[model samples]
Each structure stands twice: as C-alpha cells, then as structure tokens.
Target: MSDHVMACIDGSGHAMAVCDYAAWISQRLDAPLTFLHVLDNHPPPDEGNLSGNIGLGSREHLLEELAMLDERRAKLAQEQGRVMLEAARERAIGDGIAEPHVRQRNGELVETLSELESETRLLVLGKRGESAHLASEHLGSNLERVARALHRPILMVPETFSAPERVAIAFDGSKTMRKAIETLAASPLFERIACHVVMVGADVADLRSQSDWAVDTLNNAGFEAHGAVRNGDVETTLHDYCREHAIDLLVMGAYGHSRIRRLLVGSTTTAMLRSADIPLLLLR
Candidate 1:
C-alpha cells in the first residue's frame, strides 16, 4: 500500500467517477491503487425524548428501534463499500492494474483518511459526495475536515474530466510548496502536460535564483515548464491565472505556517475549496 495511490470511496456516483480518475492517474504514474471506505458514526438517541417513556415495554421498544437503525446504517455502509470497490476493480482491470486492494474502516471519515495519509502517495477524494447537489464544487461535509487534518497531497476530482493537458501550480516558496514542486518534478504525470508555476508573494526578488533553478530542473527533465511572480490574494490570483491560461488543473500546497493560526484565522486552501471551480490538487 505504501507505493499505491490511496482513494476514498462511498458508493456515490461522484466517488465512482473519482475512482476512474484515480485509476487513470495510477496507470499514468505506474503505481498500484488502493480504495478505502469509511462508515460514519451517527449521533446517539435524544435523552430529552426519553422522559416521555412510561413503561419498560416502551423502553425496550425504543432500544429495539435504535438497534435496528444502527444495523440498517451498517448494512448500507457495507453495500456502498462493495459497490465502489467493484467499480474500481473493474476499472483497474480494464486499465491493466493488477489485483487492486480494498479496505473498510468503521470510524469517523476524517480520522480514517488521516491514518491513511502516511502510506499514501496521493489521497484522491471526490469534490462533492452523494449528499451534495449536482455540479457543485463545494467539498463534501467531511472532505473539508479531512483536507485540514490529513498531512498529504489530495487530488480532488470533479464529476466529469478528461486527461489534463495543462496544469497551473500555485507556488509560494514555502516548505510544502517546495515539496509539491519536487514531487511534480520527479513524477511522470507532468511529462505530457504544460506546467505553469506561479509564485504568489513579494519575496520573488530574493527567490529569483531559486526560481531560475526550478525552471532549469523541469526543463532538464523534458518538461515544458515556466515560472512567474504574481502579487495579489492567493485564491483570486490563481483563479484568474487558470482562467486566462485555460489551465485544466490547479495544484498548490494545502496551507502554510502559522498553521496553528488556521484554527483562529482561516486558511487559503479552505477558501479555495469552497470557491474554486476547477479541479484542485492539494499538497500538505
């Protein structure tokens, strides 16, 4: 699983589409793929409503109802898991991926995703889950929380997509940004795409040397890459740049230091997830 692409599935049509993207990317990167399904625990029964119960018969009846609800939810989660895994398995077989693996976890969605991050090369999640409205870019109820908690790269897939011809990378010269840049440089997924690396900050004058070095690095690897310095709000700048260049994908580090400050102050990554219409590849 360490060398494989890790993806989350919930039996939703959007999740199945994400599986296709994951399979495509895995084949492109020559990596195996693993699918994970998580069962979300529901809230407990309302204690306030218990006061109306008169007899042990009523108490027993309520307990049985609650137990039935739990059993039904569990069955639904498992069914969803099987559907997603089967779809992924079929896609993998078609794409020549051998014996893909699937796992199930009974817990909170965010925690399960976080636990998988360490061994995951890329955590692929749907832009929106089953409960969401169609054509919405809003992250699923759990995706936003998972993105903030998981310290790994996440590729958020839209409902419909073709192979990306061009990509726009939002670089700010931070450590995680550098990590994402290095990962892309080494990965062959960028080989067939035109890459535009945009660094948003006023410190570009000082980073001029490093920027030049990065361009050379990509060029030497046969990548058609370019670097630019832009000054403005990060989300707005990247959005406009992608629109202007007709970029099919947007890649950027998930967040920056003052990381703890994100608890108090909001994060740019979260802002983009809510508002950015394009597919986003987020790195921690």
Candidate 2:
C-alpha cells in the first residue's frame, strides 16, 4: 500500500548499481524509493600481535579497540547508505519522481527485507558484493537463501548495469510463476515496461493453458505482454532469449529443491545467476 521500492544497500559498489536500478524503477512507477542497509556479521579487525595480550589492561585495551571498530563500522555503513540513497534520490528527481524516504536496519538482509514487504512494492538487491562479479562461478550463498525465504519480487541488479528497456519473465507453469505474474500484474512497475512472458520446457503440449492464462492476466492488468513457448533445456532457452533479444533484465521464479534434486536436475536460476550477462528479477 505504500507504493515504495525498497533497495538493499551495503558498503559495496554493487549496492550503488542496485540504487541505480531501483531509481529507474521508482521513476517509471512513480513510487518512492527506500534504501536499506542491513548490518550483518561484521568482520574482525587484524590482530597482528595475537601473542602479546594477557593482562587486565590488555583486555581493557582490546575491548576499547573493538568498541572503536564497531563505531567506525556503523559510521561507515551510515555514510555509504546515505550516499547511495542520495544518488538514487537525485536520479529520481531528474527523472521526475518524488523524493524517496531512506531507512536503515541492523539485522540480516533477508529478515529485514521480508519484514519491510508490508510497506514495500518491490525489493531491489545487488547480485553479489564488491569483490565478485555476477557471472563469477562462486555466488554468495545467502543470495539464494534470501530468494527462497521471501515471497516478494526481488530485482537483482548486476554490477555496471543500466535500466531495462525490455523485460522477460521466465514462466514454467509453476505456482510460484503464477504468483509472480499475478504480483507483477497488480503492481505499477510493469505499466510502462514492455514485458515478454517466456515459457520454456522440453514439452510444449501443456504450455498452452499456462501461456494463455498468463497473457490474459497481463492483458487484464493493462500490460501488453506476449507469450512464447520454447523447446529445449530451461537454462539454454532462457539464455538464448536474453541474447537474442538483448534483454536488459530477466524475471524468474526462484526454484528451491533438495540438494540431491538440484544436483541431479540442475537449477535454471543458479545456472543463469552464475553466467547471466544481464540483471535478473527473482521471485520466490
């Protein structure tokens, strides 16, 4: 009901990219943007002299050092969050969007994002931290976990990315896909964006109903969406679509299966996350 876009921010440069994407969305949708910085586990400072501390004064000094470190970390977080939020606010203003309200939280990113859904229209997040690339073989383990834990639509901003011109929604006829489609339809984000609903699987016999339903749903919601059914592996088909169309961003339902199941069948989302050239909007 708040009609605000919530963007997750940290001290990473990719978080700035998230703000850029969120600002684009907020402007297009005419929604306020909220920047959130979650204070997860902090890293410990270097203890170069680990063998020289064994006295009461040493203990006190250590405590003081830790307290100072904590204060510095908190200040750094606040400053980075403010700068990112200001960048987004300025971009939004230039694009004719109203000023956004920025807020911060001290908790796990997943928990804070889920808790803010009541007042958030969409959640935007970066693909990974500053040290890694979105196409890197190693992804942040928490990223997938957060995608699985939340039911809201999450826009994963890739580093050095731009706003989307055309969007593709990965549809596999799953309940989560239906929910994602429904959520996007009822929301204002897709009002001006050109959306293409893609259904990919080995078989196409049963895709008609789902594709028709999706098209009808989008049409009813005032979106001009077209349906396409592809025959091949899910990952291959999706990657091909993105490449062929030069898609700026992709929307897919995050698939969560057992470890064994995932290993055996493979995960489309994981594969794409590992090698995707564009940003992804994931919904669970």
lDDT of 2 at 99: 71
lDDT of 2 by residue, 1-284 (tens): 65778887766667667767887888767777777766655433342223244455567667677677667767776677677667666765665656766776777667777787788777887778643444566676657767777666677776776767788998878776798899889987767677888987644567977898998899889988888888887888888988887778898867556786456333767777767768888777
Candidate 1: which stretches are off by over 4 Å?
43-59, 132-137, 201-204, 207-210, 259-266
- Candidate 1: the clashing residue pairs are none
**TM-score per candidate:** 0.84, 0.79
- lDDT, candidates in the order shown: 0.75, 0.73
- Alpha-carbon error at 199 in model 1, in Å? 2.0
lDDT of 2 at 145: 68
